[model samples]
Target: MKKVEVIQDFPEVELVGRKLGPFKEGEEVEMRPWEASVLEERDFVRPVRDFSLTGVRKALIREEKSSRLEELPSSFYRTVSREVRRLREGGEVEKAEELEEAIESLVDFRIQKLARMIISSVDLGDIPAEEQVLANFLSQPLTVWEGSIGRVFEKNIDKEVGVHAKKVRRNI
Candidate 1:
């Protein structure tokens, strides 16, 4: 579940056999991702992070540093960055800073999770299907793990090659 803010008043809605929100504008709510997406499509709600301009900036910076910027459609980040700058210029400094911190925390959490998955895959000599998908989506080359685990295993071929072979076999 993720946090989202109601952008407009909305009557009660049923979700997954449960009732959620007859929410008022500006009300913050915790909701499942699917629920959020439904509301977002109507422009009746937006993710909490969307309210923070500085957070968007920091997230973009982190994505660039990690070489994941290209993984996202350019228009998405560009739109966010434009809004962030507008908010800053409008003197919403405090709000922007707070949002920046939140975004940074979120990005750090993701990076840590990726690092853990990489290490675990190295130790186990096999990457989970979900982790492989995530790594690919992030444009994180498997070769990045080569140095750390290349020779750790007794196999003559490199670990990267072995992992690629496994991935191909699994796909087939």
Candidate 2:
């Protein structure tokens, strides 16, 4: 983030700095005239999109092939299990549902990706958010992992819970 110039008494700033017209370091730009200020090209701050994330990590995992996808759902489950255990151990069941939701989304992501149906798996209206936003960088087969392992991931996602298990296959 660039250093924010504090405009005195305004207590608010125009988005993209457009409303601050004809600014020189010490100029007092009138708020009313600032609304339509055209910013010079030099004043524009380019937005960054990290393209490495979605492609690299996904490719790395896919390179591991069936073994990786087979391991992934359990891995997600284990991670959630560990966190839930900690939360429950710390006596914070009040927030368990939130944690569960996060786990579901993650697992569902893998399931949908492997299923080659991410378009229908999640709400499309959700703009890509997170490190995985780089998914566009991936190739097709790498973008969507398939095989018996996908079925395994699908099966593992709803694995039956033992009497003392932390997870249960009860419908979401």
lDDT of each: 0.62, 0.41
TM-score for each of the candidates: 0.34, 0.25
Model 1 over residues 14-120: C-alpha lDDT tens digits?
A: 87798988999999999889989988998999877643555455655665566322132224434455665776899987776666566565446555656655544
In Å, residue 119's CA in model 2 sits off its true spot by 14
Checking candidate 2 for backbone clashes, the offending pairs are 19-34
Q: Best by TM-score, which number?
A: 1
Best by lDDT: 1
Model 2: per-residue Cα lDDT at residue 1: 28
Model 1 scores a TM of 0.34
lDDT of 2 by residue, 21-73 (tens): 33444333333322323222234221121112242244334534532232232
**Cα error, candidate 2, residue 103 (Å):** 0.7
Steric clash count of candidate 1: 0
Model 2, residue 141: displacement in angstroms? 19
